[model samples]
Target chain A: MTANDYEIREYLPGDEESIVRCFNDVFTDGDDRFVGRDVESWRWSFTDNPAGWRVYVAVCDGRVVAQCAAQPLRMIVEGAEATFAQGVDSMTHPAHRRGLKRPGLFVNTANAFFDRYGGADRDVVHFGLPIEQAFKMGTTFLKYEVVRTQTVLGLAPVVPPDTWPAEVERLGAFDEQVRWLYDRCSGAFGASAIRDATFLEWRFSRPGATYVRLGVRDEQGILRGLAVYRRTHLVVDDVGCVCEWLVPPEEPEVAELLERGLRRLAHEDGATGLALVVPDWSPWFAWMQERGWRVHPSVYTMCSRHWVRRLTPLWLRNHWWYTLADTDLV
Target chain B: MNGRNEPQQESASAHGYALRSYESGDEAAVLETFNRVFAAIDPTFEPRDLRTWRWLFEGNPSGRRLWLAVTPEGRIVAQCAGIAQRMLIDGEPTFVSQSIDSMADPTFTQGLKRPGAFVRTCLGYWDAYSGSGPDRDAFVWGWPVETAWRIGKSQLKYEVVRTQGLLFATERTFAAGPAPGIDVAEVASFDEDVRELFDRVAPTSRCIAVRDAPQLTWRFLERPGFTYRIATARRAGRLVGLAVFRDGSFEGVPCGALCEWLIDPDVPEAGHALAHWAFACTLEAGRDELVVVLPDSRPWWMLMQSIGFRVRPTKYFPVARYFSKRHHPRWLWDHWYYTLADTDLV
Candidate 1:
């Protein structure tokens, strides 16, 4: 009930099961609309991830009450691979969600995470899609800055243009050709997730996943653009979600290919339309809106704690190349 | 707008540096020296390539005026530039220029020393160009860094108008759209309606940039690196007010930027309707928050506060050099309806 009632510390080995219960209790209430992930998926995300995870949990009377975590990732900073972390899975137990006017479980867990991972050696920057509550706590207590807000746009179901590039094709998995496309377009951004073979394979080609990979080739058959998407019913009833796209603004034809591919996939899936979250500064927002996409504002917010402010210019948030795949949600 | 202050004559003849107007061939040298000095002093500077330089210096609608200070050997050491801007004072279109991209070779001397190359070049240019008369800039203003602010204040006698506050508010704080019985429309082009809207709104605020179709086209549409959305409020088929905004992100968060807003002072509904339209557009764009920088005394500050904008901790200083007696320095903060877009940053 008071300041001395709880203590915050790193997540111990035995805390996984409690963390699962905590996640379900905080995020799910047996709601039919939302499916709560089990301990297996939690383990796969927090423990089995190749880049490793840094997690912090708050304990009161020796029971886990709140948690905050960061999933390690390799980010491209000035053309060099640098260590980064995506802040995610922040939750405070419902019973302990008190002191609405004062610091409590949320602040303590966030502070613990910041103390552990908010260092240059640990993370170049810790970024995540925070909710309203998390955003407040992060800014008020943990020195987090709102990087930008992500908006969800709904794409209307429409027939593909008759001139849909004939070069557009679907790939079973990511290949060197896809990597070349990513590398060629990567320079369009000053900072972003490192989409090398390892990261791309782990992201889009994982087992037990249903991601559709689309690509376009130039006359010589060199990969020019790529997109990875799947069907989702989160914001829109049933829509194709292009979570990641690899095309530069200079390459208008490449963007057209990716758009055509997503539309074709959505049409075949019998989905009403396509919905994707994009940062406001992304050129793709205007591109999609110009093509008659309806924008529906979502509640997602992105915040960051800079380990070294100068490592990357904060203005990278204004970049056009950032995609939803850069977040850990993908 | 040129600050109507008595011109302080300065001559580079006293110093070893020779001052001259920018010539066609001087572009490459001036640009190189600019990049070399700025890259060392400011980290945020993106090294200017030929294309960007040409666009900023040559493609500017109000042509650029650059004065350079060079050594006897013709090595460009210092440069001062006045980037011309078209603004409306009261109701008439007027030309103003921002003194920007000022730099001197650090290898020379530090601060405003007696034999000042930087001060002489900048001040000398101002002595020649600074005036409120018809031919000269209406008034000159700029947002200078702390060091430059001190130099301008102590050495050049520039008056500090107000320190700008960057404010933010969530979409929930604002109403959905225009006020009841007031109509709002998204303007696709700055046409006759925009000119009429400007005519109606110019008298409401003390100072404003005339939002005629041509000026609006050049400021918002023709400007590179940004995409702007223009909206207007109308009553009985007549334009009453207008707002300009764009979807932007702070860091990476979705946010909206209020660039310009104008309303007819006589018609109360116009201001309310235009503010509502801007807030609604930002909310509809899915921006969580909206940001604008203005002096706290402006009328919009109170109106926005009513709708839930709170001043953030950070502040930017806005200094003005008034060249016209018609525009009082003391009344600048309250009378003008300035927005973030009025500054060079937008």
Candidate 2:
């Protein structure tokens, strides 16, 4: 089929079945990032998010061939609440990979998605944590800029530090204390996704995703630190990923206590070690290095396309309290 | 053109402005545009004087470079200036530049498109001064606060050397550690002997400003509307170390800053003695904290951290555009030893 045969348009109500088929066909069968895609998981990401979808598709006579879209995010920009978009599910079927002689179906569909959603009025900026080649193309053709090189800190399993009591327990759901904890922790960032109970409740409730929520409590049984973990063989190795790590930078003792408990859990889950993400500039980076956690280069690079003038490249780079939980990859 | 030998002019129609090199009489116009632009955006900006402007742009002994963007009405709306310094990079003498007074008036550039007049002005400046050439600077850089940095990397090819970290002493008082036998003395001006001290310390860094007598005089001594307490540490009548301090405010908060600190690598005690003196002087000034920036990967970081200081990264990335392999950013990152005085922002 020629590029003229493909029609690029927005996502309709019944596009999930063909979109999943297109995704499975586009991605390698046993790829680490995309082991597989099912209709149920696809719907959970696209339609079930509270912030809604920003999807676009290329249709050739009712057959999906390429798709590009984002899962909307509610973020606080320099203390003022705003909505942001995280670009995801970027795929193109093998048969129509190059578009032969013109701008491809994937490019057309991706442009349609960005044209619909990329702006300050819509989501401030449309960003993604894409691999290197995608980042280069996005920067060259689509006006994307590097935000940060994701830095992941890793340490092998060890006995818990005995200086403080590691009394963390499994939490069933995020509560009011988690919201308060987020409020106290957000001051350390220039910008970040809103980690309130409303967002977390919807974020962690994805289908077929298993996560262990752990929290450390105070004498009054108030949650002081929280960590969301999953022991999986990631792109790197078998490790307990700290999918979400939330605690005040000022309270290193509380962070250590929670970390001690996670190490125990990670060891019990047969994980090789615990891997956590902390920006290289953060005080927590030094804390982790002091505790013998070495920084490993990550495959994902954070990039963004700015539609807002005020949210300049440096403003976003310096301010954002970004973490793995902000992206759909985790 | 004015027909009276005005600065060399080049057509810059991309933003409805003309670009030109600096001439002798352009100081007042440049200063006016700088003060006006900064006053509009930064409330804490202190108005600059013509004498300081003349001394800043014209007084550089190594070299001076300036460019301005002017309207058809002869209004100087934007400027790209560099106060150049001589340095020994990769075993050869070379010139490096630090940008000061990078400005673009909002009134003149309100609705200009992306890669606006200000960004284009900077690009024009870089093309003339940086990259491979016999007379080109090793690299030109600026400690852009935010707007400049944003417009720079997105438009101009700015590669960040590092997101510099600041070390702040928790308490303003001196530690109870034993004082070294080095004799610390306050100096009225940097004498010719200071050059010798800098030469001894130059080998420790790969790309460093040759901080000799001329640079120090223009940097700290001759600067207008500011005073830095310059202290020198001597061992057996030999200059072993130096430190400069200022009582200042940032964002209207009363603060103290250690502007410059350099000690001989072989004489670690001299660094301790200087640090102790800085702490005691700041304590006498009743400051809450003493802030300074140093590469955290350096030996000085461990020395300062041991003196009850904590390091936190600042958003200020000292970005650069290089011309030669001698001043590559990788070499600069690991071996560029600089202090607050090196940048014009402070």
Candidate 3:
């Protein structure tokens, strides 16, 4: 039969079992290169609708063949404004493939949908595809313009008690204040508006993370600075992940305090190094650069779909790197 | 966390509007106003039925609060909402206030043109009550890019996390190509032998796994607000492949989602049969739109293109972290097939 004999359509109510069968047939054995599957993920997919996201299917000749889906792009970027779409799971049944020509049908179908519903007035449709497909499709990679990479700095050797700062008489009081400050500013990234108290109770109180938090206070017991670090054994060796470090934007000696505090922790804990997540434009990065902190190779890219006029200049976009630890789930 | 003193109030005139707590009896008016507003934006927006409204206002255990800006005539022109919750920041205790579902009267759209004014009003409400502490942050989860741009200038910073793309099968180019070698079957029931074939092949598939009975039943048969269809392929009475789809909509666009498609790797031709079957099902159902969630990987894209699925330039940021760092490396799975609007995962 010719390809015209086939047709494409939507998934019906009873298709779940057959769909599962098709999935199992294609991926007969799970790849060991990846982590084990958590059934909860699948459960979540079937339920939970914070935003009204949707999915679609392709059928031909009364049989299920290819499928594609989309969801709302929820994050905000520093500048530029546009609604975004996340394209997920586009695949064809193996038996239906008539060579390289089949995948084009899928792409053509998706593009037609976008052109009809996306509205020409929209600024840009943003999504991440594989680097190879991106090249083939001629879609611009937002990371090239929006992302900033930096070499995260690790902690230095700790100084002895004799070398502690002269005004460090009230370190205990300082720690409390720093902790208090962190409680207030935790959800700046918009994942959740949960306040500091709940965050501390849930994350740090747990044991598996092996995190140690510290505070640098002034003589007046004001919380001027704070940092949270965790011990982790990387592929090569044990290191510290600086989950957080916050100082008042106005602090004059913030850099010196971070240096001394980190050094002391490293030496006391026998840590080989400490990896801190900082905004690309952080002053601590420059300080670390001067102090011989080695810069790693990978840079985390942040992209957003927003319709607002550029308020924060492009130059200031790299001012911060919110660490994974700062999020609620991590 | 100790409650701090309230923040200094900014001049209401500076914002060109007054912000206040939503009143109890304003629910109906607010919902009506929003429905009208969205209808102006897009006629297809589904209004909240009474049951859905009750769920939003009373059924939810999360103590969410709503605020609105009223016109001089007592009409609710603008509205915003917040959910009080806690999140971690740098391993410290933090409280966050999440904002969502801000809407304004279409007639006053010109007055609301100052995006910064609305944002300031919303944030001022938070700071005045919640206080800016280390852990206290304000969040907006799903603001459209245009809306984000209008108000993102002030204290709030915007980061784009996930994007959705759309595809339509307006033309059937696959019909011009050669046909598949295997037989594609459409069965009304998944029998024992079919189940056995599925179980045997599921453990090896990339996107489909053998789900527990509870999950299978709940996701497919038990879920409300969606119509699901399944199609399977068999060779010599042994199940070799299957594909699934859900009848749904996206923001009002009638569509069908290809939720899953799997075939034995040994019998690659089964993949083609599944795609052809799925496409025909979509057409028969009279749905014009189709969507899929694929990872930023190559092999899956190639498979999709080979069978008439077009790529919509979009990406989804599926945030995942290992529950325990010591357990195993984080694995990125490209398993999401097409999804339906009513599906909860989105």
Candidate 4:
């Protein structure tokens, strides 16, 4: 069919089956990572927020040959109100594959639909094409760098925690203190939420995972700092993992607290060393550096697509990883 | 360049119209309203980054559309857009569609004074187009909690779907000491005896099989990100254990990770051999730390601690669903092991 023979139009009321078939045909590979929802979830996107949705279809010889749709972005990151638009279930019927003129026709029609109903200038469009197709389209590939960090604790030859301050051992008693530190620090990275008591219990109190909560208290027994570490079972082997170590950002004795906690883990647990993961930009990095703890590099990439420049600062955008000891997820 | 200028005035007649195409003169006004709405929601967002503005005004054929809700004074209050051929979702038989970059002029929200109205308008656009029946099976991705909460559960149901894990590598160690039970020993290479040991253990283990030289090279040695070390353990001059390690990031920490540690389960000493060899290799490589991604249910935690590996909680979201069923196929996933240098390989 010639370009003139086809009309590009908004999706009408009766186009459901045609669209579904088109979707099935286009997504031939059974990979359903994102669109794996049942029909109910598919319908929910429409019924929930209809006004924010738009679809366009191309018709030729009384049959719909191609279609496209977009919706607003829901995640509000940083300070930008961003919209994410995806090109959905777009396809050309098999019979029309031989027709060379359809692509331009369909493109023009879909663009028109976007202009009329969807505000293009105000939305960010995110689309994926196969590596070959992306190369064919002259799209630029953006690079994201991943960073890793490792922590090493120096073990005292013979000193263990029992010989240290009583407050160091008492730090393991309160779970809330650990949560407070995680929320204040890890929350900034959009890491796992630690507000729920159940989540905290599941993370800290679970079997197999080792880490004892340690706290540094004032003379009044008020909790001022907290750290979590556990020595591997002597029978299991002798390494110790520092699950968490946090001092209030305002705490003046943060260094002392860290030292006290580390010495206790090393001396009491009979550990060879201690390791933890901290964000690259975290104060913990400087803290570890000042204490003369040996640091090593790790490998892992953290990447993100931003609608607006929000949490990704130029410096923090570099590589950073949490040590297995520092994170809640194994 | 299809540019046209028009005053920012909305006609009363245009208030409740269902769906209409954009007129030539509506471009700048639509863009202006969008910037205003976005600014209200996030002041830090630069107005120019919105690709919709450029696509609509600049006339790109990559399938972009902009629809608006016109006020009585001809002002655009709410708007939505559809871009063609964008993202792909995991399992759905549809190209991904996003319902984003929307803003309801707070003046309109306050004048109407009903939060529900803005939601209703947003829902109206989504329902009219994104629904399954007709022209497209587009799925919407990335709806944050605030948007989902505002629309109400009756209208929008939120699911905590899994995506890929974002790992960072850093240069600090968090383990308190050397893990217990791990015999720290050094080995030279994966010779024939070691290969036989690895092959014998492959059939019974859950680890990915690396029987042949090509498979071994491709899966372990060929990757460009990290330096690899091969170690083997022997008892009675017969190979009984093997550990393959690489330098990589765990979370963001610089460390070595035991990507593969296999011991003949039937041979009790094999475990010790493997652990000792691996640790010695890590130390020999001059890595101050190491991490292994273990299954949530694996007994490796004990093994890790025994050999000087500390437990650090890392976050990773690996989402998968079966194409034919509602439940995910559990077998497809591997408990990943990470180290400081490995992060760069991927």
Candidate 5:
């Protein structure tokens, strides 16, 4: 279809099913990377998000032809929490193919989405870990500036600390202590996703995925650190995917104890090593390297569009503490 | 045309401290501030002597430009300096500035309300040396440590270019050794052979420093305290590859790094052969692995990975400010062919 034939507008309450169909058509047709998105997961990602959602779709003959969507997030920016959004589930139907003239439906839909909800008044920053092609499009048309290239650090199974100083316990649910530890941990970063227990509950409640939570408690039985991991064989071959490993940099002993427990946890799953996603600026990136972890460039490069002057990419480049859990995919 | 103005000279005076371009006799004061500032931050920092300082700054071939914040009594309180680089961007002679030793003594900044002596001194240097003009640098760049990076990003408009990372190969699998008709040998000095080799490789690079014989000799061969191993790879008697290595330690673990590598991309085998040699030599020298830094967009990135080199993020985040619209941050990052030799740290 030509650009004139399609109508692009903000997401409506009932547009979820058609958008998911178009997304699945564009993604699951031949690409091994996607398994075809379901409407329930789409709801859980955007519609059910506590912060909010901003999505736009291209309508052709009453069926969704293309879509651009973002999952709203409440992030701990500086010291206070602010609303942000992560660009996710962007796709266009192949049946329409190229518009063959002017700006196409996909680009128009994306532009409409950004115009509707981008900037400080809406979502302060629109950020994502886009694939290379999407990143090029975002930078070329959507004014997306690169934040940094991400790397996944891998650590081989290692011997745990002989005498663990803290009690390592599996967390069946995130409690008030997780919020306290998250607040304390996020203080070290200029910007980070709000990791309150509510976020953890919604984040790890993936329908089919089992998220393993390990908490480190000090001698007083107060939670000092928390780690969340899961096995995603499709993601990186039998390696445990670490979403969050939060302990203050000053609490190295607690981090060490948490790591020891996580290593044993991952080893129990018959994994070769544990793979964690962390940004370059995170102190843990260097910490992992110092501990003999092997780091490799991940397939995704982080890009962001800053609307508020407060969170420029330059400031975020040196300060943003991000991990796999910050992303919608994880 | 898009970058900020970099005037030939910049001066600022405030609260009993004056910032100006380095004069001949100001060397001692500047050197003292540099050593003292660095030593305070790093306990193991080796104090640079006058000879080494002169060789690094004054003896540079392109030229020397250092700005120092000095008291009225001529004691230097802060300094911002750059080791000039003669680079070839898109096959044109381009003057770039590589900032080094940006330091300020706490004693000088203690009573200052805001924008202390260190920031002021660096501003003078940056204003006079960077941005767009016939005499100005195409860009000013540096690998500032984490603390300095924060200040630079916030105040000096230093955009993040790329976070520097190294290609480390811990286990060599005896692959892609010297091919037939290819020979590798250590060279005592760079000469016409190295110059011609660079001439052949220059056209293929979007951005690269002019690493001719004299430049190589100045950087790796004649540099004062470090003994660097310069190796050449010859294919059927013509120089096709050049590599330099410095035996050093990373985080107290004995390791060697391939500091510089230049070879034609068409002859990927030459690079592979040179890498194999470097890896073997590093292991032989009692180092566990060979580490290197190269832009992942360069042709050699995949080749290095194929041979065994794995990527690891470094402590450095490469930052730069560009003068021309033709040269954006990503443009420099994706095309620049640089290694550790491009930096002063190695």
Candidate 6:
């Protein structure tokens, strides 16, 4: 009808159904890359998030027309634990796409979300890998900064490791040992997601099909590195999809051992190649290239809003340790 | 007019901050201050590890001269690094220092704003390290983000050498005609052939990095984490031009990065051959876009523009300051050949 016909509000209990519809209509009902979503998936993404989820919606005549959500996450910023929010699943009804003007439904919902949860006391920092349209709107109107452009790294012909350097084993789930190793590695980074046992178990150990957990241990059986990956298909026929691979930045030997083991595992899984996503400034990026990985350009941009410059900056992509699983869409 | 300020020597201020040359044990404090300021500027800023720090500062072929601002208690509150590289300037390979890792503690900024403590620290370092003579770094230049650019241009008297933009291929297929008498092939390493090609090209090209075998090996080959593809163009079994590229992305779009291209300035045919090969290789890889960061003066920019690449809104301000009066302002932009790799941020 008109711009004034819609009202922006926080998500209530019964808003899930309308939110799911909007998500599907905006993401799936078009030529976008995302797959179709259902009510259950939506609930799992929003309600079941480990750090909790805060959502704002635009309701036009009692029907959700636009939605913006932030999933809270504990991050290690400069060796301190901080709250960072990953802005996810923003969508507007196709009927209202470009139909409304100045402070439109999309912007209204975003403004509400920012007003509610986008404060230093609340989330501290908010970031997302949004499409071009959202990126333009966020930077031009919402005061979001262009962080770093992301790219997909593909290594084809993942040659099997000739010799394993360390003890490699498949793990049932994350353990305290994993947390200890993660803590040691996480400190070297400027900004990274909290990969404690709780975060790992909650993230990878989802109910249906869980990720394949692999660990590399040293001579004294101390955990050196961990990798979470699964088999998937990309441009190549068979690809080993790496979700999250963590190794201490200072421990180059352990990192090399872990990479070799991961490559061996991928080859054993009948994968012709391996694929993963990394920020351009990732510490691991240079290593990936040194090992002959091919970096493919992606169609995604990491946009961010820094509510507190002291704790976090808009350019956190270089410090972020993100995998496909970090995204709710995965 | 933002005029240049001559270098001056200053000691530790009674105002709580002291100035000194960098010492061995000061790296940790310097890195801490660096991360604090840089992370606040761009959260994605990579925290420099000891190895990388050593590689950048300690392993510079010419040598290092780092200046820092420390507290009375000896904790480094600010750092300014001048990493040197050899570049062809006025037909001579001269040392040009890229001013990098410059940062001041946020708490100190209130008292250390422009023309204040930070500016004095920079001038102090410049006075001691930079000069026009054979013994000194000829000039100091850097690609500063907008905020730093303004400070340099407004207060520090840095000249804008060129304004660079991100250009993307507008069409899926790049339009080009085949070049006769030029052969292009992908090569595994840089050899004397490439070095000879560089010598043939460097004298005529402005502000071009001197790409000898050692520099080439260090820049592209010995790099631990990235793979670079090199395309060589030859005539009668002699190297005339070369193109260095890598597969990268911009805003999630596949980008063919034309990192560096050196062709014999005498042979215009080499540009067409190398450009054609670069476009064809990118297209063959199924890239969504081919991109390169170049100044408007480069002959290759004309070649890129001819083949559907259009300038986008993204801009990088290239600024520089000459230490010697003998330097001409126009030499910075005239006939210069640069790519993304030339920038320290990469």
DockQ of each: 0.01, 0.11, 0.01, 0.02, 0.20, 0.01
TM-score of 2: 0.67
lDDT of 5 by residue, B199-273 (tens): 788887788887887678888877888899888888878888889988897546578888999986567778888
Identify the leading candidate in terms of TM-score. 2
Candidates 1 and 5 compared: the better one by lDDT is 5
Whole-model lDDT per candidate: 0.68, 0.75, 0.45, 0.45, 0.77, 0.70
Q: Over the stretch B1-346, how does candidate 1's per-residue lDDT look in tens digits?
A: 1343333443346566678766678788878888898898878777877765666667666556577787666677788787676666665656667778888888765654664777777776776665665446666677787678767755665554543445566755554345665678887777777777666656766676555675567678767667899887777777777778888864345788778777666666676677666677677888778876655655666555555564432325566677776653344654666776566666
TM-score, chain B, each candidate? 0.82, 0.89, 0.46, 0.40, 0.92, 0.84
Question: Model 4: per-residue lDDT, tens digit, B1-346?
Answer: 1121221333334244323335667777777877777776765655743344553323332233345666545666666554322221232223223344556666665656443335555554455444342233243333233443334322433221222222212234233333244343444334555457655654542422233333344445544333577665566566666667766555556666667666665664566555555555567667765556543323443444444443333443222112222121122222222222212221
Better candidate number, 5 or 6, judged by lDDT: 5
Judge candidate 1 at residue B96 and give its lDDT: 68
Candidate 1 off by > 4 Å:
A1-7, A29-32, A60-62, A98-102, A152-154, A157-159, A162-166, A205-209, A218-222, A233-235, A248-250, A276-297, A311-313, A318-321, A328-330, B1-346
Instruction: Report how far off residue A19 is in candidate 2 (Å).
Output: 12
TM per prediction: 0.52, 0.67, 0.33, 0.33, 0.64, 0.54
Q: Which ten residues in a row have the lowest lDDT in candidate 1 chain A?
A: A311-320
Each candidate's fnat, listed in order, reads: 0.00, 0.09, 0.00, 0.00, 0.32, 0.00
Off by over 4 Å in 3: A1-330, B1-26, B43-48, B52-77, B81-100, B105-117, B120-140, B143-148, B152-155, B162-255, B259-277, B286-289, B294-303, B314-346
Quick one: best lDDT, which candidate? 5
Worst 10 residues of 3 chain B by lDDT: B321-330
**Candidate 5, A213-303: lDDT as tens digits:** 9888877878898889887752467778787888888888787777877777776777677888776666777677656565655556678
Candidates 2 and 6 compared: the better one by TM-score is 2
Model 1 iRMS (Å) reads: 14.1
DockQ, model 3, C-alpha based: 0.01
Error of 5 at A326 (Å): 5.9
Tens-digit lDDT string for candidate 3 (B38-96): 77776656776655554444443323456566654567657766543333323334333
lDDT of 3 at A93: 62
- By how many angstroms RMSD does model 6 differ from the true structure? 15.8
